[model samples]
Target: MIKWIAAFLGYFLFRFPGAVLGFIVGSFLDNFGGSGNRTRTVFENVTRQSVSPADFELNLLSLCSIIIKADGQVNQRELDYVRQYFLSTYGKEKANAIFRTFNQVIKKREISAERICSFMVQRTRYEVRLQLLHFLFGIAQSDGQVSKAEAQKLKEIARYLRVGQHDFESIMAMFIKSADTAYKILEIEKTATDDEVKKAYRTMAKKYHPDRVVTENEAIRKGAEEKFKEVQKAYETIQKERGLS
Candidate 1:
């Protein structure tokens, strides 16, 4: 049993050093090397507590910085967009602190979007991942358009996060408006009838509804609300174009 636990810890320690360390140190006195049942319980508790809201925000901002630098130059529009998002979501005091920390982290090392996305996929909920994708699109389009480099980087991050093509395209459509973007945003075929479009819109809205997000964090809920609004706009655009409303 100890061998099994050690092996498990060893595997995760490389990938999640901080979490594994906390799990080990925090459980050392209480449950380390205890009965199998007690050890299992401690393991479950530690796993559940591994990723906190602060951790999520840091990873998100770090990845956002990576996207901002994808085009080889950080434009003022991208920086302004990030600052505004942080201020709105986290408030001025917290946002300023987080923004400073993120800038320092980015300057210290080159972050790998794949690594960040992989970590997020393992730690975050699906709804949170979708919201992160929405933010990524926002960053990509901050400078008026998503350059080829930025678009490809976003695709790579999406793939690493295990986001489906439909979801990726749906979020992309929200940022890059076009004749068929509304249909793509709703994940419906362009040839679909009015009823089919309506059905698709309803299903997507339900899936992305802000209330569907299970987090207690207001920032996360606010992000989800934005996504919900984007979904609503897509449906409205489609209906108006087809004269269905």
Candidate 2:
């Protein structure tokens, strides 16, 4: 059955890049079997829409490599975080393949951050773009702190993505724990009344909710879930500090 599906995909997607992508995707589907069915839905949607799965995956890998190398050297911790992410999202075989590809891209350093970001901005939905930014933050913090170089690179990526400063700051607050970070995460001013803070929290909670991401991709939804949790934690921190219930 899987062979038939792969053959069918290969036949239909016989074009150069699509043929190659179809073969890879078909193999992934074969490995996933029942558990991977959801990815097929996402694949179908991508085929019908703007970006192909291969392009999307490659763009992610390219941008991730840029983040990993932003601070002079790539740490094992950052590599491990990326490996774990791909493993949990795409299974072991695909994860290993992606890691290898990522290494090659990094070694070549041929893909520009601007080119990748521009492509993503044109093809990816806003929510997915935000999720990507969130993931970059995770990569930067893999070594326990986001360095100045990494933060600047992230800001550049966010600017290219047209993500609002508030939104970028909100995501940043999640990884950086500072006295003002909680307020930034909630997008509320410190001078706001307790009621105002509560309102901001609710607004941010609703905005960053996992369900609001509107994608069939479970991995993307899971990333949004992390953002959702960050919002909740930020709100709680604010309440505790301000002596509000």
Candidate 3:
């Protein structure tokens, strides 16, 4: 019922994540409906939908499922982490509803990580999925340490996401020396004078400037503000390196 509703609504009615939730919940209800057919029902409904393939929601859910099941047990703390993150990053109302729905659906089943990943691969893209991989790594590190299971899951996700081997290695690398954070970011160098810094700032200001961000969504605008700060930090760091105040 939940998966069907979410799938029907999200795919047919265009309700975004609501549909995804519907699918997950519906399957749970169907299998456990005082009978034992929810599994079959969930599988059928999943087979019915096709548009949500690979990139966005599908891959996200798949990766999350793997992470949660990595240690052979999913704890309340991890669940809380995911819930809080969704609430903060997405929205409170949606997060609350999703949590309730998922609890109602998956409280019984313990599906394998491989099953989730199989479904995920069917929906996500092969490239640029490292961003999602990095997100998982960040979440796993939220507790001040990463578990062995988390590390294994990260490697699997990295492979599935097709992140370059070098990029994967550098994901853990730090403090070699950027040499020219400014030049790397702005395509300018140390020899470039104050005027050059000003020019670089100008170009970067245009590139990372908050005003340039589309303001239709206030949330998106805030993200732009963060990006703007990074740009400012890089420019200032460069300027200070050259004693330019």
Better of 1 and 2 by TM-score: 2
Please provide TM-scores, in order, for all candidate models, with all chains considered together. Answer: 0.63, 0.69, 0.45
For all candidates in order, the CA lDDT equals 0.66, 0.69, 0.51
Model 1 lDDT-worst window of ten: 38-47
lDDT at residue 63 of model 1 (Cα atoms) = 80
Over 1-245, each residue of candidate 2 has an lDDT whose tens digit, in order, gives 44344434433433122223333344445554524222332123332334444555666677788899999898999888767655544568977876766777677645567767777666556765776687688789989999999999999999998899998998887777787888998898888899999999889889889778786544456556767887898888888988898
In terms of TM-score, the best-performing candidate is 2
Total backbone clashes of model 2?
0
Candidate 1 wrongly placed segments (more than 4 Å)? 1-58, 84-109, 209-229
Put down candidate 1 lDDT per residue, 53-83, tens digits, no spaces: 3444556677878888888887888888767
Residue-level lDDT of model 3, residues 82-155, one tens digit each, is: 57555543357756755654564344355444544455456443322433454566556555566788777777
Q: For model 1, what is the C-alpha lDDT against the true structure? A: 0.66
**TM-score order of candidates, top first:** 2, 1, 3
| Residue 205 lDDT (model 2) | 88
Candidate 3 lDDT at 186 equals: 56
